[model samples]
Structures are given as structure tokens and as C-alpha cells.
Target: MVENMHERPGAPSAGDGLVRLYGPRFQSDPAAIYREIRREHGPVAPVLLEGDVPAWLVLGYREVHHVTSNPQIFGRDSRRWNAWKDIPADWALRPYAEYQPCSVFTEGEEHRRRGGALSDALAAVDQFELRNQVERIADQLIDTFAESGRADLMAQYALRLPVLAIARLFGLSEADAPSLAADIAASADEGEEAVRAHQRVVARMRRLVEEKQARPGADYPSRLLAHPAGLPPEEIPSDLFLTMGAAQLTTADWMGNTLRLMLTDDRFALNLSGGRRSVGQALNEVLWEETPTQNFVGRWVIQDTRLGGRHIRKGEVVVLGLAAANADSQVRPASYAHASGNQAYMSFSHGLHGCPQPAREIAEAIVQTAIEVLVDRLPDIVLAVPAHELEWRPSVWMRGLIALPAEFSPMYADRPAG
Candidate 1:
């Protein structure tokens, strides 16, 4: 049996093998756990995921870059992976790592083709109009909870605004967007629910795509349909499925984490209230400290390679240690130094497979606008419980609060102009 690192001395470590990435232990204080793992195992730590899935988690600043930047050596296609041959097809990790027709799992000419279609679709978004949409969505969402005197920001505000914004961008009717957004959130989880969620999202996106193809509009789906990439019928929905799901989830989490930090920490609260810092600064700070997706998976080994001085066999999977890399001593001499600059952070996952939507400015606008609206509407907002008592989702990948219960003086909703 593998010895457990977290076990108290003299206690049995039997049956406890590689470090489990799931559970309350990792969820409660992942930063502390990440530091311990990096210290003992250096940059490349062998970790066991939920289903006893063994994979190397790359923790160093330079090491993560090395693996992510070299697509020739470490391919994105999980179908090439040989490690899962013996593992059950229904293993928890399969849904995330399984082959998909989208850019996340593709490489070479195929990736460029699909990725370009997505890039063009995103580039078409008018920055000015997008920011306005974000502000509008924020106001609409805030109207729902302003008079309640108390709210779970995670559910009522942080979550709703992004989906509404995405729906507007995709040209989806208000009625269809919320259900699609729910599917996106569910897709981020593990187990049978995630599988079902994936299916539902695909079906929903396919219907949207077919409708768009019949009567093309100036929105994202129509743009993708018109792109010279000439995406196949089967692949069209996959593209929408990947892009919409990614945009809604990441943007929501980014907003949620930033708001949580602002509400819980005096440093953030005082700065914002006193005008010492901008919402953009708060965003940069959160990206460095508590990036929405702490770990990115599915970079398969194309050949035997040395990553961070450790030998990795072919077909082995390497997960990007984004949150760890941002906090790595080598990247920043001191942890707190990350808050000083708005420079690039690994929160976007670098290299050819990096995220393209919600460009920096768009993300900044969405999050900044959302927070500003909340503060404007409820200036006295404060956490209903101790910051430490807030619960985090138990998933190994997602980094977000389950709910952010806050209290403030009741105010009537500001009715929108007809």
C-alpha cells in the first residue's frame, strides 16, 4: 500500500494510494495541498485522480509552459492515449479526456481549421456592444435580488449574468439560454449527471445550429456556419457545444471567485470601497491566486519525454498546473507580488490550445461590470457567515464557492425601461 502524506504519524496508510485530488480535504485548502505537493515532488508530481487514474500533474512555472507549448511532443488528442486501455470505459475521467471533434482535443491542420472558425466568430463580437450587454445583464440580474435584503450571489448574480450575456451573443432567445447554461454547469461536474448534461447540451446546440443554418443571422452560430472553414454538419454543433460551454462556465467562475475575494478579504474590500484599487486590479489578483480552473487536463504524451527533469513514458497524460504555476516561486519571487501587475497569467492555459473567447478585455468588462453593479445596488453588502465557513465545490477541477450568502438593506428592484 502507498503511504499517505496527510496521515498522522503511526496511523495506517494502507489502501490509501496516490494522493486523491477529490474530496473535502483538497477542496477546503487546495493551495496548501498544492504547496506540499510541489515541495515534495518538485514540478511533476504523480497523482491519483478519483478513479485511481494515475497522471503527472505539472506544477512548475517553466515546466507547464514546456509541456503546453510543445504540441508536437505533447498532443491534445486523447484518442492517442494508451493508458486508458485497461481502465473502464465508464471511468470518471473519461468524459473529460475522451475524444471530441472540437479544438480542445484536436491538433495539427484540424485544430487550425476549427480554431480559426471559432476565432473568427469571437472576433466578430463588437467590444463596445459586448461590454454594454454585460452591464445590461448585470443590471437585470441584480434587479432579481435587490429587494430581498439577502442573496446568494453565486446563484442569483454571478451565475445568471454570464449566461444571459452569452445568450445574447449567440442570438439565443431568453427562454432557451438559461436551460443551456444549466447544462453547461452540469457538464463541468463528474459522474452520470455530467454524461447526461453533455448529451443535453449537444442536442440543444444541434437544434440551435440547424435553425441558424436555415436562416443565418449576424450572431455567433451564423458566423460559424459562414466561416470558410466549412465545418461539417456533424462538427458544427460540436464547435458551438465547446465554445458556449467554455464561455459560460469560465466567465461565471471568474466573476464568482473575484467577488468572493472582494467580499471576504479586507485588503480587497477596503481597496474597492476606498477607491484604492480598480475592479480590473481585483480581477488580476484573483487570476493569480484563485484561478477558476486550477488544473487543466488532457495533454497526452506523444513520445517518451523529460518534463521538469522527470521521465514520462509515451501515452501518459499531463495535466497543467495553472494555479500552481501562477504561484510558483520562480514565476513570482513572492506570492503577493502577483497582485501588483496585470501581466499574463496561466489562468487562460497557454500555447496552441489556449482559450480564445472572452478576450481579456471582454472578461475584464464582464467581471468588473458585474461586481460594480452589485456594489452600486447594495453598498452595504457583507457576508452572512464567516468567510471560512463558505463551501467550495468538491470537484478536483472547478474552483468556485457553492454559494455566497450576503446581507444588505432591502431595496426595491429598479424596473428596466420598456
Candidate 2:
């Protein structure tokens, strides 16, 4: 292991080493960072983020899973901690609330009750009625682009469906969905732009909250706002908005990544069960091979305790790289295990404080529906340009193709005279 890693008392076996988050060379290549952490240091390596945000880089799957799952030791409380994160309190509130959910950060019965309530509500979507609604939406999406025979699958097909589907979950009207979704997607990130975007959405959400409180409409948000049925309200709008954003972003990300993988990864999609299962498997591959939320902002070790290798005093931050863990081969049975769903993944996270949705089956179903439609309805479709020329959006914490440029024959309000 590199001497750069420091030692700490009572550290886990994996934590004895020098880990750094800011190196000029590593700044350009995060994959290399993961490689070094796994090959040289233990899966748990001590590091800092963006130069000074102190943390440990747990790049291996087991270590990350353990860290994420243990809320008792590694706290999820943002207010009591994360003051060093330095975003505006209001700006940070939305994303924090979204991931942590209604008392998700807490340990013991509060978490179980809140998580259980959410689970019960979410389970309601699996009913026969919701299935019909989902099927109708899936068919409608394909039909919209079906005549054209050529559509930007991400922009036209994959992106819109999840936004609308989540909107349906909230019982929102289709007419008002576009703006609402747009407003929510912006609150998912952290930075200057994220703060600005959050403020704008906060206003919109505040209006909706007040309106729902007054009128008490049929939407879940309305009922949540009113608490009419003796259900506790979970109206921290920023988080709700980010939940929507997460619902849209990761789904859209998998959609595009799935297409790219199917198109490029040795034609893996063609080998699937009648391509009947491309959506589930491909989506899994996308998460394992290239997750959207690579590094998640997290912190612990306040009041000076040992974490990773180094012993530090008060006010330190820790960032966990979920993507790195997803790709870590050590905890995985093989490099491709997560892609095959053989290993439980950091993609959906684990434990009480994890993502509050029943994301697995629902997301798979959504992806599967799209794949089924594309394979059945648009077989001749192929990438127009050599994929190497296609561009990807590069960010510290996200992985996705920015735009997919390809031409398919005879589609989308742009075909020549018949």
C-alpha cells in the first residue's frame, strides 16, 4: 500500500494505509483511483475529496456495503453533521431529505416504521390497476414513436416514460407533469447551479404544498400534505423533488446505457432470452458497468475518531464512491457478477437508510418494457455513426452519454414525402 495512507486505532483490517482523494494524476482518471485502491491499498483506503473534504475511499464492494448498511456507527444525520459540506442549508435540504427520506437517517424503530410505511404505500403500485396503467403508458410511449420507426431512444422513449410514470405514482395530471419534472431534476446535484435550481423548484414545491394543503386533491402529495387519512405527511419538497429526479435520472441513464451496451458490448442483448430479458439484464449491466451516481457525499468521524487509516479530530467529511464499489472485483464473485446480478449491489444501496423506493422490480419492469418494445417494434434500428465518436458527459459523480446521435430510417415527423 502507498505510504500516503495513514493508520488509525481500532480500524478495520482494510483501513491500514495512506489514501488520497486529490492527486493531479488521479483527478483525470477515477477508474485508476479505484484500481490503485483495490490493488495496492485494502478495499478501505483513507482519502479526502476535492482536496480537503476528509474521508475514506472504500472502493471495494464489501467494505462499501458494510459502511452504507451500518447507520448506527456511520451516521446519516445531515443536520448534526455535514455542516462542512458548505452548501446553503436550504440548498442541501432537498437532496438530503430525498436520500434519507422520512426519518431514514435515524436508527431502530423510527427507520423501520417510516421505511415500512413507505414500503406499504409503494407496494400499492404493484396492484393490477397500476400494472394496467404502466402497460398503457408503455404502449403509448412506443406508439408515439412507433410510426416514425426512428427515435432518439433516450430523449423520446426512455426519458419521458419514467417521468410520467412517477407522476402517475404521485397522481399528477399529465398536463402539468413536464414542468414539475423539469423543476425536480435540477435539485439532484450539489453545487452553485444545483443551489440555484433548488431554489426555483423550492418555490414551485412550496406553492404545490400550500395548494395541496388547502384543496386536498387526489394526488399522493396532496394527501401527504393534508394528512387526511391519518397518514403522516412527508412533504419535504426538496427531497420529494430529488426522489423524482432520481427516479428519472437513473432510469434514463440505464435506458441510454442499456442501448449502448446492447449495441456495443459484443451484442450481449441478442444473446438474451428472446431479447425478452434485455431490459432487466441490460439495466443491471448498466448499473454495474457504469453507474450514474458514482460517488455519494457522506461524512463521519466528527469529534475525532479513527476511520479508514488516519486518526483525525473533529469536523471531517467522508465520501463513498458507490460506482467504485459496484465495479470492485474483490467482493464480487467476478468482474461481471454485478452485471449479471449475482452480487447484491451498492447501486440500490442497502440497510435501513437506503433508497426508499422498491426500485428493483419496478425499474427492471420499466426497462424491460422498453426493451420489449424496441426489439419487437424497431428491429432494424442501428447506430448511424461509429460509437467511438459518441460523447459522454464527464462529471465527478455521474456517468452517462450526453447525447446519442444516430440515424434510423423513416421516423419522427422528419421523414421525406411519402
lDDT scores of the candidates, listed in order: 0.77, 0.58
Q: Write the per-residue lDDT of candidate 2 for residues 1-418, one digit (tens) a residue.
A: 2112557343322234445444445444567778877676555655644323335566766666666766655666655454445533454333543244344454577656555655554555554554566567777776776666456666666667777877777766676666655554444543445556656765665566666666775555654444323334443464355556667777767777778777666545443344555556667767776776677666454355444454533444445778888776655445553446554668776666667566555665666666666666555567656877656544445555656544445434445887
Q: Which one wins on TM-score?
A: 1
User: Candidate 1: where is the Cα deviation over 4 Å?
Assistant: 1-16, 270-277, 333-340, 413-418
- Candidate 2 lands at a TM-score of 0.78
Q: What tens digits encode model 1's per-residue C-alpha lDDT throughout 98-188? A: 8888777889889888888888888888988987887788777777777888999888887778888888888888888778877778877
Please give each candidate's TM-score.
Answer: 0.91, 0.78
lDDT assessment of candidate 1: 0.77
Rate residue 322 of model 1 by lDDT.
Answer: 89
Residue 255, model 2: Cα distance from true site in angstroms: 2.0
